[model samples]
Target: MIKLVIIGSGNVAQHLIQAFAKSKEIKVSQVFSRQKETIIPLLDSSKITTNFNDLIEADIYIIAVSDDAISKVSSQLPFENRLVVHTSGSVPIESLDNKNKRGIFYPLQTFTKGKDVDFSLIPICLESENDSDFDLLEKVAKTISNNVFKSNEKQRKALHISAVFVNNFVNEMYRIGNEICEENKVPFEILKPLILETVNKVMTLSPKEAQTGPAKRNDMQTIEAHLDFLSNKNHATIYKILTQSIQNNGKEL
Candidate 1:
């Protein structure tokens, strides 16, 4: 079995614990967290501790901490020359302490609190300084997920940026849709099927090919009607800008 030690108590760490729970090949031997109470609900008291000095011997030490704290956390490890990895998309493997072997095991997905995610669907992006270390990382990753990709820091950062545009920015657009619905006393649930269908269409079609709306058709009359209907200046400005963008295909919108 591949023994593992996880450091952190946040959504990523907690989710990892749950994913590894059913794995026969990988065992989470111990989890270190300053806020031990926060992780105790997921792991037993025997396997969770606040002291880094009390860390158990493991094949891999997974630091699932924040990006800023990754270097600091790796530097604080009492042992050296161990295979240590961090779960960060943007942070490079060089950010780890040189005392030990460094690698990255970034799971490309937004982990929300109190929500269980299907780890099998998550894309596990792996990077390491050595081929041997990468093999170990990939082995662990495959136990929970089949979608594993070998990515360097630059590629990982690009993926993260694209994810932000597609996931985070798209969510903001949904929020704006909700606000517009509320302002007009329209039921937001009524739009859920349309939203789902739009998503389904994009699965088999390019976003540009799937695009359909007054903006895509360059219907200026309908665009102006939408702008005039929106009372919020911010919403109107955003609508006009986006409509122009769609019509111009990103040319001088």
Candidate 2:
């Protein structure tokens, strides 16, 4: 069995620890967190400590700390020969500053505490400096996910950007729709089916092909009416910008 230790006790750390615990080939030997309370629930009988020197011997140390604290925590760790990996997508693998075997085991999905993750559907992006280390990382990833990709630092950075655009920006659009519904006294829940359908359609059709709106159809009258209906200046600005962008794409609105 490959021994593993997880550092940090945030949402990402919690999700990873729970997932790794279920794998037969992987053994979670210890968990470390700066705060005693944060590590309480996850680290039952396992070796749990706040001090880095108390870390148990393991083949791999997974650091799931905040983006800024990765380097600092890594520098304090006592082990030198063991493989060290971080879970941040934006942070480069080199940030660990370890001369020993190092790599990134970034799970390309948003993690939330108390929420169960469908590990099989999540993409695991692996990167390493050496061939041996890459193989080791890939093996661990494949245990949980079928969708594994070898992405370099540059590629991972680009994917992170695209992720923010798709997930974050789409959520903002939902928020705008909710606000509109609230003002008009319409039930926001009524849009649930349509919202789900929109996502479902995009899976089978290109986003351009699935696009539907007055803007796509060049319905200038409807666009103008929608903009006029929106009392908020920010909403009006967003509508105008999106309308122009959709029109430029040449999708039959």
Best by TM-score: 1
Q: Report per-prediction Cα RMSD to one decimal.
A: 1.5, 2.3
* lDDT score at residue 235, model 1, on the 0-100 scale: 88
lDDT agreement of model 1 with the native: 0.93
Q: Write the per-residue lDDT of candidate 1 for residues 112-210, one digit (tens) a residue.
A: 879989999999999999999999999999999989999988999999999998899889889999999998899999999998999999899999899
Residue 199, model 1, lDDT: 90
Clash count (model 1, backbone only) = 0
> How does model 2 score by TM-score?
0.93
Question: For residues 1-253, could you state the per-residue lDDT of candidate 2 as single tens digits?
Answer: 8888899899888888888877899888999977767767766845678888889888888999999999988888886867999999899888896755789999999888888998888999999888998898888888778899999999999999989988988899999999999999999999999999999998999998999989888999998898888899999999899889988895466
The C-alpha lDDT values of all candidates are: 0.93, 0.88
**Each model's TM-score?**
0.95, 0.93
